[model samples]
Structure formats: structure tokens, C-alpha cells
Target chain A: SQTIHQWPATLVQPVGSPLSLECTVEGTSNPNLYWYRQAAGRGLQLLFYSIGIDQISSEVPQNLSASRPQDRQFILSSKKLLLSDSGFYLCAWGPSGGNYEQYFGPGTRLTVT
Target chain B: AQSVTQLDSHVSVSEGTPVLLRCNYSSSYSPSLFWYVQHPNKGLQLLLKYTSAATLVKGINGFEAEFKKSETSFHLTKPSAHMSDAAEYFCVVSVGGPYNTDKLIFGTGTRLQVFP
Candidate 1:
């Protein structure tokens, strides 16, 4: 069975600080990875998605960026965090060229103070 | 362009009662629809998906949804609601195809509260 994992389950950072969140998938190769943010009492907003290594797409223009260093490793980074960046970050993976259904990781809750 | 709308921002129901979460969508092409549930402080879970196959889709936790093309709606339903059913539900629509990187448009989400 395939599983998605995310680190720093909870994070607290001061404003203007650098941020990094990691996501890795096991038992699957060449999977589609996505980054999403969910604000309090709101739905999810797609930030970035990668179909393969070094192929990343940004959905929204913001303070965040994404990279796919390895086949199953994806990272979301921010050079400087903003107060608006405080939210729950979710990582998801889907089978390449398969059904569009996605599986999500435990998620990272970031609080930018 | 693809978009999804979850009608109710919050719904309250008693345990053992039926559950109905309404969702409507708009898509220029053949759309793939999905329903995801999120417990508090947890990641989203795929409850079910409709990919141009059957109109009636059954998902985990004895939940099901019917796709009404004419209405452009995919509403999730459960015969009996449990306390565990209290969570936020999101309706999503995928734009593009399998060969390309499809984007998922999510609804604002509906918070379901089940009381025993």
C-alpha cells in the first residue's frame, strides 16, 4: 500500500522567517504531488503541483514555492513567511496517468506570529 | 474552467438520521468529481469519486453520492449518520485529463455536525 508522509506536524514561526515543509511518498514511484493550504474555517487552496521531477506548476502567486528533488520527495519552501501564510499545509499524491483521486498526508499546521 | 459549490456551510443532524450534503459544479469538459472528508486537525480523506463512469458512486463509511448530469450536481448521502460523521466535507472538480496535470477545484466546504 502507498502512503504519504509530511513532517513538522506543527510549526510556530515568527513573521519574516524562512519556512520549509517536507513531503515524501512510499511504495509508489513517479507519482503526482501537490501542495495545498487550508485557512481557518475555509477550504483548500492549491499552491503547487508536480507531475515529475523538476516539473512544478504554481497555481497561485504567493510567498511559497515548491520543488521535487526526487521522484517521491516534494518540498514546499518560503524565503520569508507572512502573517497570511499561517494555515494548515497538506500534501497529496496521485497515481500518474491513473484516476484523478488523490491521497493526503497527515498535514503540517503552521502558525506565523 | 471548472468550479464546485457546496451549498451549505454548516449542517446539523442527530445520530441515526439521514445525511445529505449538497454540491453543484460547472465544467467545460467531461468532469471528474470527488468528495473528501476532513476530521478536525487531520488531512482530507477521499470518500468517493465519479469519473464519467456510473452515476451512483459508493464510498467508504457507508456513504454514497449520485451524479445528476442534468442538474450538474453530486450530492453525498448516508442512510444513517454517526457521531463520527461530524466533519468538514469538500466537493472537488478536476479540470483536464489523465495525460496531463489536472487541477482540482475545491468547494468552500460544508461542516457537518452529528449529535447523539
Candidate 2:
């Protein structure tokens, strides 16, 4: 069975601090990875998606960025955090196909103060 | 362009009552529709998905959704509502094409409250 894992579970950071959230998937290879943010009362927003290593497509223009270092390892990073950056971050993986159904990780909550 | 609309922002139903959440979608192609449930402070879980295969899709926890191409709607329903069913439900659409890069568009979500 395939499973997704995300780390730091929760984080509190000050403005101007760096951010790093990791996501790794097991039991699958060459899977498409995605990162999304969910704000209170707002719907899920797609931030970045990677088809392969070193390939990333960003949906929204913001301070955050995503990278796919390995086939199943994806990382979300930011050089500096903004107050607006605070939200719940999610990682998901899916097979390469016309079907867009994805499996999600536990997610991480980051609060920028 | 692909988009989805969940008709209700919030719905409250007594336990053991029938549950119905409405959703409508727009897409240029024969879009794939999905229903995802999100508990409070939890990641979204796939409740069901409607690909081209079946018009009626059954999901976990006694939930099902029917894809209506003529009406462009995929509505979710359950025979009976359980207290555990209380959560926010999202309607999603995907128009997967050449690159498989078609983004999944999410609806505003409908909050289902199961009352005792």
C-alpha cells in the first residue's frame, strides 16, 4: 500500500524566518506531487506541483516555492515567511494519468507571528 | 476552464436522516469529478470519484455520488446521516489533458452537521 508522510506536524515561526516542510511517499515511484494551502473559511489553493525531479509548476505567485529532489521526495520552502503565509500546508501524490485523484498526507500547520 | 460549485454552504440534518449535498461543475472536456471530506483541522480525504467509467460511484461510509452529464452535476447522497459524518465536503473537477497537468478546482465546500 502507498502512504504519504509529512513532517514538523506543527510549527510556529517569526516573520522573516525560513520555512521548510518535507513530504515523502512510499510504495510508489515517479508519482506526481503537489502542495496546497488551506486558509480558514477559504477553499484549498494549489501552490505547486511537480511532475518529475527538478520540474515544478507554481499555481499562485507567492513567497513559497516547491522542489522535487527525488522521485518521491518533495519539499516546500520559503526564504522569508509573511503573516499571510500562515496556514495549513498539505502534500499529496498521484499516479500519472488523466485521473486527478490524489492521496493526501497528514499535513502541517505553520503559524507566522 | 474548469470549475465546481457546492450548492450549500452548510447543511444540518438529524441523525439517521437522509443526507444530500448538491454539486455542479463546468468543464470544456468530459471532466472527472470527486467528493472529498475534511474533518476539523484534518487533511482532506477522498470520499468518492466519478471518472468516465461509472455514472454512479459508491464511496466509503455509505456515501455515493452520481455523475449527470446532461445536468453537469455530481451530487452526493447517503441513506442515513451519522454523527461521524459531520464535516466539510468539497466538490472538485479535473480536466486532465495532454500533460496530465490539469489542476483540480475545488468548490467553496458545504459543511454537514449531523444533529442528534
Candidate 3:
């Protein structure tokens, strides 16, 4: 079975601090990766998605960026965090040939003070 | 372009009663629609999906959704509501063309509250 892992399950950062959230998938190769954010009581907001190494599509302009440095590794980063950036961050992936239903990781809850 | 609209922002139901959450979509092509559930502070869990095949799709935890293309609606339903079913439900759509780029667009979400 395929599974996604995300790190720093919870993080408390000061405004203007750098942010980095990591995600890795196992049991699948060349799967699509995505980064999403959900504000309090809000829906999922797609930030970025990567089909392959070095190939990424930005969904919305935000304080976050994503990269696929390895086949199974995807990273979400920010040079400087804003208070509004504090939210639940989710990492997900979908099979290349399936119905394209995304499977998500445990997620990271960020609180910027 | 593909978009989803969850008709209800919040719904309250008594436990063991039926559950219904409404959704609609706008797509240029035959769509791939989905419903995802999120517990408080948790990542989303895929409830069900409609990919132009079956209008009635059954999901885990006794949840189901009906896809009505003419009405552009994909409404989720459950025979019996459980407390664990209380969560935020998101209606989603992915563009179907080659340029569609499987990026899923989410709805505003409907908060389901099951009361005993």
C-alpha cells in the first residue's frame, strides 16, 4: 500500500521566520505530489503541485513554494513566514494512471505568533 | 476551468438520521468530482468520487454521493448519521482535458454536525 509521510507535525514559528515542511511517499514511483493549506474552518487551498522532478505548477500566489528534489521527496518552503501563513499544511500524492484521487499525509499544523 | 460549490456552509442532524450535503460543479468537460472529509486539524480523507461512470457512488463509513450532470450537482448522502461523520466536507473538481492538470479545486466546505 502507498503512504505519504510529512514531518514537523506541529510547528510554532515567529513571524518573518523561515519555514520548511517535508513530505515523502513510499510504495509508489514517479507519483504526483501536492501542497495544500487550510485556514481555520476553511477548505483546502492548493498551493503547488509537481508531476516530476523539477516540474511544478503554482496554483495560487502565496508565501509558500514547493520542490521535488527526488522522485519520492517533495518539500514545501518559505523564505519568511507571515502571520496569515499559520494554518494546517497537507502533503498529498496521486497515482499517474488512476482516477487521480489524492491521498494525503498526516499534515502539519503551523502557528505563527 | 473547473470549480465546485458546496451549497450549504453548515448542516446539523440528529444521530441515526439521514445526512445530506449538497454540492455542484462547473466544468468544461465531463468532470471528475470528489468529496473529502476533514476532522478538526486533520488532513482530508477521501469520501467518494464520481468520474462520469456511476451516478451513485458509495464510500467508506456509510457515506454516498449522487452525481447529477444535468443539475451539475453531486450531493453526498448517508443512510444514518454517526457522530464520527461530523466533519467538514469538501466538494472538489478536476479538469478533464489534457491541459486539465489533475489539480483539484476545493469548495468552501460544509460543516456537518451530528447531534444525539
Candidate 4:
């Protein structure tokens, strides 16, 4: 059984602070990874996705960036956080090929004050 | 370009009543549709998916969704609503060519509120 993990479960940061969120998957290899942000009342926005190591795609132009350092390890980072960057961050993984139904991690809730 | 629309931003239902969350999608190809549920401050969970097979799909926790190509809709439903079912639901569409990295387009989401 495959599982996705993310941390820290919750974080509170001041504006202009750096941000780093980690996601890792077990029981799968070469899976596609994705980062999404969900704002209150607003729908989820896809921030980035990676097909493989060093192959990252940004869906929205924002302060956040994503990287796939290892096959199953993905990281979301930002040099400086904005007030608008506060939201629930989600990490998801899908099979490399086929239907592409994604599985999500527990998620990280960031509050930029 | 592919997109999804959740017909309702919020839906309130009494416990034991039937639940319906409507969704519509637009896609150039035979799209793959999915319904995901998210509890408060939690990550989204897969409720069901329609991938070119089984118009009627059953999901966890007594949830189900029907895919109607003519209507371009994939609405989720349950016979009886439970308090635990109160959450936000998102309709998703997969966009990509035959050999490309598929991107999922998500709807704004419909928040389900189950009241006793």
C-alpha cells in the first residue's frame, strides 16, 4: 500500500519569512508529484508538479517553488512568504502512467502573519 | 483547455436525506473525472473517479457519482446524508494528450453541510 506524508502539520510565520514544506511517498517509485494550495472559500490552485527528478512544472506564477530531490521526495519552498501565501498546502502523487488519479498527503497549514 | 464547474458553492442537507452535489466539465478529449472530499483543514480525499469506464462509480463512505457525457456532468450523490459527510467537495478533470503529463483542473468546490 502506498502512502504520502507531509510536514510540518501546521506552521505560523511572519511576512517575508522563508517557507519550506516537505512531502514523501512510500511504496511507489517514479510517481508524479504535485503541489496545491487551497485558500479559504477559493478552490485549490495547482502550484507545481514534477514528472521526474529535476523536471518541475509551475502552473501559477507565484513566490512558491517546488523541487523533486529524490524519486519520492518533493519539497515546496519560498525565499520570502507573502500574506497571500497563507493557505493549506497539499502534496499529491499519481502513477507515472494511466488514469492519473492522485493520492494526497495530510497537508500543511501555513499562516503568514 | 479543460475546466470544471461545481454547480453549488454550498449545499445544506438534513441527515438521512439524499445528497446531491452537481458538477459540470469541459474538455477537448475524453476526459477523466474525479470527486474529492476535504474535511475542515484537512487534505483532500478521493471520493470517486470516472476514467472512460463505468458511468456510475461507487466510492468510499457510501458516496457515488454518475458520468453523463451528453450533459458533460459528473455529479456526486448519496442515498442518505450523514453528519460526517459534511465537507467540501471538488470536481476535477484531467487534461493532457495521449503521451503527456496529465494536469488536473479542479472546480471551485461545493461545501456540503449536513444538519441533524
Number of the top-ranking candidate, with lDDT as the measure: 1
Candidate 2 lDDT, A4-113, residue by residue in tens = 99998999999999999999999988888899999888898999998889999888899999989899999999999999999999999889764579888989999999
| Candidate 3: regions farther than 4 A off | B96-100
The residue pairs in collision within model 4 are none
TM-score of chain B of each: 0.96, 0.95, 0.93, 0.95
Q: Each candidate: RMSD to true structure? A: 1.3, 1.2, 1.6, 1.4
Q: Mind giving the per-residue lDDT tens digits that candidate 4 earns over B1-116?
A: 89999999999999999999999999887889999999988889999999988899999999999999999999999999999999999999988623356678899999999999
lDDT of each: 0.93, 0.91, 0.88, 0.91
Ranking by lDDT: 1, 2, 4, 3
Q: Give the candidate order by descending TM-score.
A: 1, 2, 4, 3
Per-residue lDDT tens digits for candidate 1, residues A1-113, read: 99999999999999999999999999998999999999999889889989999989888899999999999999999999999999999999988885588899999999999
Q: Rank the candidates by DockQ, best first.
A: 1, 2, 4, 3
List the lowest-lDDT window of 10 residues for candidate 3 chain A: A93-102
Residue range with the least summed lDDT across 10 consecutive positions in model 1 chain B: B95-104
lDDT of 1 by residue, B28-81 (tens): 877899999999999999999999899999999999999999999999999999
For candidate 4, the lDDT comes to: 0.91
- With a 3 Å backbone cut-off (N, CA, C), the pairs that clash in candidate 2 are none
User: Candidate 4 - CAPRI tier?
Assistant: medium
lDDT of 1 at A66: 94
Worst 10 contiguous positions by lDDT, candidate 4 chain B: B95-104
Candidate 2: list runs displaced more than 4 Å.
none
Let me know the DockQ for model 3: 0.60
Candidate 2 structure quality by residue, lDDT tens digits, B2-110:
9998999999999999999999999888888899999987888999998888899999999999999999999999999999999999999875634576578899999
